[model samples]
Structure formats: structure tokens, C-alpha cells
Target: MPSLPLRAALVLMLVWPFLAQAQPALKVALFEVAPYAQKEGGALHGLYIDLVRGLGAGAGFKTEIALMPFARVPLALERSEADLTISFSTEALEGAAQALGPVALVDSVLITSLARSTRELPQLKGALVGRARGGCQDLAQRAELALRWTDISNFDSALRMLALGRLDGLCLTRDVLHHYSALASIERSRLGAEILVGQRPALLYVRRGLAPEVIAKLRVALARRSPVKAD
Candidate 1:
């Protein structure tokens, strides 16, 4: 028979391990955007969301997503407030965060007002171009041909600004723009014109200095997930 003191000690030992095993779960930051990262019915859902869930499951970790404004993603990652981010481009990850697999997600498009404008033709050279802040650096770098840029908070704002002739053009993910255009009931005729100036491959971004094992595990999981097809 065990003494009362021995039974108490045994109980403590068993409980201590469970408490020790309850480590903090990783936090992934997601922005409210369509087909990529968005909150639907109080839950995160999208292509990137699905991919991240799969990666988390394969890596044997719990991932909790926090939805933040699009402009704040870089700041959150830099401050270590978020463990991971999705749909960022290579150039975007350079100074912001360490990136994982290419993901090779969506392509961006250059959109110009269809109306005759004072700006140059076929491109935004020497014109004011509007883009979502912290969205995709690759598109911004390519659109630097005009040498002028305007940063907006959201896609709807960019579209409205362009429609109101406040900006010479807008650069955004092609699919995202189309989705918002439809949701906003934007008249197709209202848009001046658009051009597919270039394409960019998206990637998953993690805070710099994450555990190497964690990164390797994430990469392996993403590779097994395969490339996402265009919707």
C-alpha cells in the first residue's frame, strides 16, 4: 500500500508532464483577401489557409490564424507578432521575413483606367500607380517603370481610387481584382483598360530566425501539397 505522501507525489509527477507539454501554439497572420487569405463565417478559409492547415497537420503543430489588415502584415512579421504569413512575393520576403517554399500561387496584372488620361499609354511610366501596401513587392518593382507609387490599405480602396481618376493605374493580383470587381458591382465599361505586364510567384513567409527544423518540415510538407491551380 502507498502512503498518502507517496500518492500525492505520484499525482504531481503525472500532472507536471502534461503542464510541461502544453507549449504555446504557433500564430499565423492572415489578411482579409479573397482566394488567398480571408475570414469566412468566423473561420479562416482560402487556398493559403488550406495549404497552411495541411502544413501544420504534417508538421505536428497547432496553428492559430489571426486576421489583420493587409498593410500591417509586414509590421506584424517584423515584430515577431506572427509566426508565418502567406502569399508574399520573393522581393517582399527579402527584408520582411524568411520565406519557405515558393508556393507559386497567383499572377498579378497591371490595370489602367480605360478613359483617356494624361498618363502615358501601354504602361504607367511617369504616372501615379496605386497598389495595396505590403501586398506584393514584385509587382511594385516591375511597375517602377513609371517611377511613381501610391500605397492604399485595401483592394476596394485601390479600385475606387482608380475609378475616381485619383490614380493613373492600379496593380494587383489578377484574380483578386476580378473578385472584388464583381463584388463591388464595378461596371466593366468603367475601367479604362488593363494589361498583363508581368507575372509573380507567391510564397509563404516566416519570421526570420525560426527553428531550422521547423522550416525544413514546413518546406517538405508544402512540397508534398503540390502547386495550387488557378481558379
Candidate 2:
């Protein structure tokens, strides 16, 4: 007969594969925003996507990614439908998840038609500005600007509105503006001016009550990746 220790080891070896297979995959959620998270050809790709994939690999957890509209991101976290996400720092999001500090930063800016003479926030007091629906627009209010706000479905639509003279300006990250514009083959001279509003840090957020070990592993991965600066 086999020794007691040998028998125990044999049992463990027999069930180890099943034990490993029983582990659940981490659920990660992201919103569709070009250059950050973009879905094309039914495949997801971009900065945040790559970061999350790397973190999951380093943490040794299988990760499942879901792409949805911005409005649903916080709601998913609130309902425990998602385990992780990356978003611009905002009170609304922080209320739903624990921010793990900034992984990147984004420059919020206002862009207008090249023909429009209004180049600054104060200059367009009451002018209509387009913003992505469900996005944070506290910058204008914080700056004490009473700009008329209009919600657009996405960056592509906002860019189209700006080009068609439907919106006085568009308020979003500078990189997003440049990205969509480039994709649409719009030239720099065609856009009026970029007014720097402020910089918002993009943070890695995990839903509350997530496994502490998982969070710790991600933190270690993030630290190893080095902090990404503003785009």
C-alpha cells in the first residue's frame, strides 16, 4: 500500500485540475470611448483594454471584458454586475466603486468650429455645447459658466454635430476630439480652437466588496506598470 503522505498527494493531484477550473473569471466593464476603449470589427481594443488585460494576466485571473455605454458603467458596478473598470475620476463613480488612484490623466477641453470666434469658455456664455450623455460636465458649472449643454450619444455624433454647425462647441477630452476628427479625416484648421478646461485623472476602479486579494494583486500589477501620464 502507498504511504499516507503519498496517498494524500495522489488525491490532490487528481482533483487539482478541477479545482483550478472551478475558479471564476473576473468581470471587467468598460465604456466605448476611442483611444481609451473602442470596439471595432466586434473586437475590443484600446488603452484601458490593454491595461486591464495586463492586470488580469499579472494577477493570474481570467478576465471577461464587457463594453457598454458610459451611463451603464456605474450602474453595473452598483449592482455588482461588474468587478472592475477604468474611468475619469468623478464623485458619482467613486460612490459606486473604490478608486485605486490614477492610472492615467485626460485633458478636458472645449472645441469649436474654426469659423466660430468664441475661443474660450467665458466667451461662449449661453452658447450650446455638446457633451457625451452620462458624462461628467462639472467643469463648466465649476467654472461658473452658464453654457447651454446638449447631450450627444457619442463622440462620433458630437464631432458630426460640430462639423454641421449644430453645436456651438463640443466638450470632451482633447485626445478623443483629435481621434474622432482624424478618423473622419477632418483637418486641424477645420476646428476652431481647443480651450483647456482642466485635467481629470483616469482611475482604476474596483467594485466594493471585491476580493481583497484580487485588489492587492491588481495594485501590484499597476505599480509595476508605472503610472501613465495625461494624454
Candidate 3:
């Protein structure tokens, strides 16, 4: 017969799978935005994707990433369906989730078709403007602009619409504009001057009332890393 210690070890080995299954990984929500987060060939890779992975390692927890629409991230966190996400620091967002820390200072811009001959916001009065669904609310609310804002399902389609004169303009981040424009082969000359909307802080957010220890570990890890910037 096997020794007592050997038999006990065999018993533990048989139950290790169940023990591992009982411990859930931290859930993260990410959206498709090139250079920040993207899904390619069934793999997630981007600046934020790498940053989150590093932070998870430093904080001593495994993570599971879910790709969803940007607008839905906050609700996921609010419902405890996800543990973390990256978003712009907005008054509305603050009311929804606890911000972990600033991840980057991103430039926002308003771009229109050069053919439209409109360089400034007020000039776009009564014109149709395209925006990512639930994005760029701050820019759209500028008192000087009196344009009709429309929700776009994707950047690719929006850029195509702008190139074809279907949209009068689009409000989005500078990096996002550059990325999708290139991917769609839209020339810079096709778009008018980018009106600067000022820099906004991109922040990491967690569900409200998350464990204090976890928040501390994540903040410490985040502080040790460099912030992402436009390429």
C-alpha cells in the first residue's frame, strides 16, 4: 500500500482542478480602438491591452478581457460584470465608477471634409456631423457649434461617409482619426484642419466599492508604469 503522505498527495492532485476553477480571474472590458485596444486574428493587442496585462501581473491577479462597444463598458462595470476599463474622465463617468488613475492625456479634435469649406464649429450650423455612438459629448456641446449630431456605428463607415461627403464632420480623438483614415485610405488633404478640442485625461476605472487592498495594489502598479501617448 502507498504511504499516508503519498495517498494524501494523490487526493489533493485529483481535486486541484476544482480548486483552480473556484478562483475567478479579474474581468476587464476593452473596445476596438486602434493602438489603444484592438482584436486581430482572435487575439487582443494594443497599448492599453499590454498595459492592463502588466498591471494585472504586478497586482498578482489573472485577468480575462471582454471586447464590447465603448458605450457599454460603464454599464458592465456598474453591474459588476466587469472589474476594469479605460475611459475618458467625464462628470457622468465619475458618477458611474471609481477612477483608478489617469492613463493618458489624449488630444480631441473636430474634423470636416475640406470640400465643405468649414474650418470652425459655428460654420457648421445645421450641418450633419458623425460621432461614435456615445462619444465626444463634450465637443458636441460646444456653444459655438449648432450642427446636427448623428451616431455612427463604426469608425470605418464614418470615415467613408466623410470622404464621400455624406457627413459634414466628425468629432473624435486625434489618434483615432489618423488610424481609421489610414486604414480606409483617406488622404489628409481630404479633411479640413483639425480643430483642437483640448487634451482630456484617459483614466482607468473600477467598480465602486472594490476592495481597498486591490485598489492600492493596482494604483501602485500603475504608478510604476509609463502612460501611453499618441503615436
Q: What's the lDDT for residue 196 in model 2?
A: 83
Candidate 2 lDDT score at position 58: 86
lDDT by residue (tens digit), candidate 3, 105-158: 788888887676565667777778888666776776665667788988788789
Which one wins on lDDT? 2
Local accuracy by lDDT, each model = 0.73, 0.82, 0.81
Point out where model 3 deviates above 4 Å. 1-23, 90-92
TM-score of each: 0.81, 0.88, 0.83
TM-score of 1: 0.81
What does candidate 1's lDDT look like per residue over 40-68, in tens digits?
Answer: 78777887788777778787677888878
**Which 10-residue window of candidate 1 scores lowest in summed lDDT?**
115-124
- Runs with alpha carbons beyond 4 Å of true place in candidate 2: 115-119, 136-138, 141-143
Model 2 root mean square deviation, Cα atoms: 2.2
Please write out the lDDT profile of model 2 over residues 1-231, one tens digit for every residue.
Answer: 999999999999999999999988989999888888888999989989988888888888888999888878988998999999998765668799999877777888888865564655677777788887646555655556777778788787778778777888888988898789988877776677888887877888999999999899888887887657646
